[model samples]
Target: MTSSPSQRLAWPDVAKGISILGVVLLHITLTVPESKDTWLAAFNVWLDPLRLPLFFLVSGFFAQKVFRFSFAELFTRRLWYFLVPYVVWMLVEQQTKRVEYHWVFGDPVFDFSQMTASLLVGHSMAWFLHSLILFNLFLWCVRKLPGWAALALSFSPILFIAWQAQFTSIAKAIMFLPVFVAAACFRDAISAFASAIEAPFKGEWDYRSFWAYSGMVGAYAIGFFIRRTWDSYAGAVEVTWLLPGTEALVRDDVHILVRMVEQFFEVPVGIAVAVAVSYIPVLSTGLRFIGSHTLPIYLGHPIGLTVLYGYPMALNPREVSLAGQWPLENTWFWLSMCFVYCAIASLVLWALGKVPVVGWTLKPPPIGASRRTTEPPSAGLSLSQKLTETRNATTRK
Candidate 1:
């Protein structure tokens, strides 16, 4: 039996929500110097393998819809959707940082050259948006290739990035490209798998709980070990060494090898986690809501972090010391701070979206300038119906 579109989409939305929360926690832990060396830090490390990879996978899942578009349609859509926001936000982030720096140091600091370079390379979290545009463009170019060949071409940069580790922007885009492409290429397979497992849970409580809890436990256990193995190797390389050039090469090789190994497990683990979480009705609903608004939250969260934590620390360390104290030593506090930041950021972006032209910075145009005769499917429609509707809508354009 076919599941409703809401049911089919729930897992992906939950996965995205989980991933974005991970992103927020990571940023919080890293930004708050006091939060370092705590359990939250360790948790973030353990979660690293699952976070962005899962995100990229979901992005690719949706990109399948875009792939149906003609080149001109796809190009224009991506430009408006990804590139415009990226450029606008890059400028906003840069100016915000400059102002913060001037406030803290009592001297104006602005570097047009450095800003330009950073924009070209995607210097910060903004890199995700920039890289996403590139990924879509690259996928568009390779759409006509044979499946295996297309995947191979998309994933070719993983080795180079693993060895060099310096081509931050391009390397990251390439590293995650395979996941995205896999989603596009195997979209049917993924949906089938989700449907198969979710279908059995219709009324069977024992079966549903067993799979949900087991998958969650198994994925986390395997994911943790994979990350630990990578960490140990990374540590060994840092402490033990050969000749200078040889040592660097060895370290890079080990890092790349471990990363590849970790990713092998990470991808499945992430999917399992998403599936498991989706079984919890309450949590699933909350995550799906967050996932739906990911674009705004992703764009705006960093600003909230900067203004609330980063700027205060930079501008007046003493004044903010008390506020930052609790998060430093308490894991609960740290987690709370992360959630609080995410909430504020999401709310701020939501408010911005309510405004007229200002809202455009956080919202993208509709996927395609397509017309539809029938009303779009409600949340109750089946996945297959929704996909058919999407195709029909695009074809009409």
Candidate 2:
């Protein structure tokens, strides 16, 4: 069933909400000169190991039904939702990227072939939308495989990634597929696990109560170590061997494997944090709201960001630290700035969504909504209707 405002899963939405926010902060620190040297940037980068992996895991859980649909239904109902927004936004992103390229480099831009390649796989911010489509198709195609074999096979993409991290959106999609497929194939077990976690709160205490507390603590420790590892590796430090008694696989040239491994391990960490937050009433409410609106924010923020930061980056001016000597001072400042940037992007989307033709580009009529002419157009779909039209997606919220 598609989620409603009242019926939504708290942790997953909270996780998505947090992940998208991190994505925006990462964009902000990356582009805004003042934030370049701050702790916020470092934190976001450190989170690289888990953010997308956790996101894909949650998405896969919602997208489990993708395998049940016929091919035409998959394309029309499922893939179409993501592809439309991704392609539509890419036009906006590319035009901005091209202008910024010229400003910075004193040249037009990249080759047509390069642009086309990114178009196919995705580049820039809308890449996650590309993932929503590709992962659905991938799981559907491999639906016949035993769940264990399918998960094992999902790692096969790593063969290409080990030698060459893909230059486009494909890199992330490939890297995170294992987690996505696992979530999709093992939804029942995961749901049972979540139920177990929620058991303590529900007053049905047992072994699950022990697991809920201990597992979360374990996740935090593992998450910290993995984040530090990623930080080191991303900074050009060579990793110690992952495989015990074997140096055959670890190499400077193949650090992508380390990154991918860290990403996989980080999933539990993200889920644990998300669940922890779910218990906090205020934070969970806010995050779940943000999670419900993932599409517009995910697709919209980059356009404003492209315009805002594109030229500045193209100019390539020296950036200094906004880092404060006081504890968490830079963190607070960066957090505020990230909110402002997101607020502006959301404001722009809100304004544009009111415009006649342009608004539809931001939000297409949710599939099959137009068919019910008797009901007022703005009345919105019933949760059941939305589930049918948006099976590939979750709640339109």
lDDT of each: 0.71, 0.70
After the best TM-score superposition of candidate 2, give how far the Cα of residue 47 lies from its true spot, in angstroms. Answer: 3.3
Q: Give TM per candidate.
A: 0.78, 0.77
Best-fitting candidate, scored by TM-score: 1
Error of 1 at 171 (Å): 2.9
lDDT of 1 by residue, 53-102 (tens): 88988999878656666876786655567877898887777777777778
lDDT of 2 by residue, 326-353 (tens): 3233445434655676768767776777
**lDDT of candidate 1 vs native?**
0.71
Task: Specify the highest-lDDT model's number.
Answer: 1
What is residue 159's positional error in candidate 2, in angstroms?
Answer: 2.0
> Per-prediction RMSD in angstroms?
6.2, 7.5
Off by over 4 Å in 1: 1-8, 103-108, 162-164, 203-226, 234-257, 319-338, 364-397
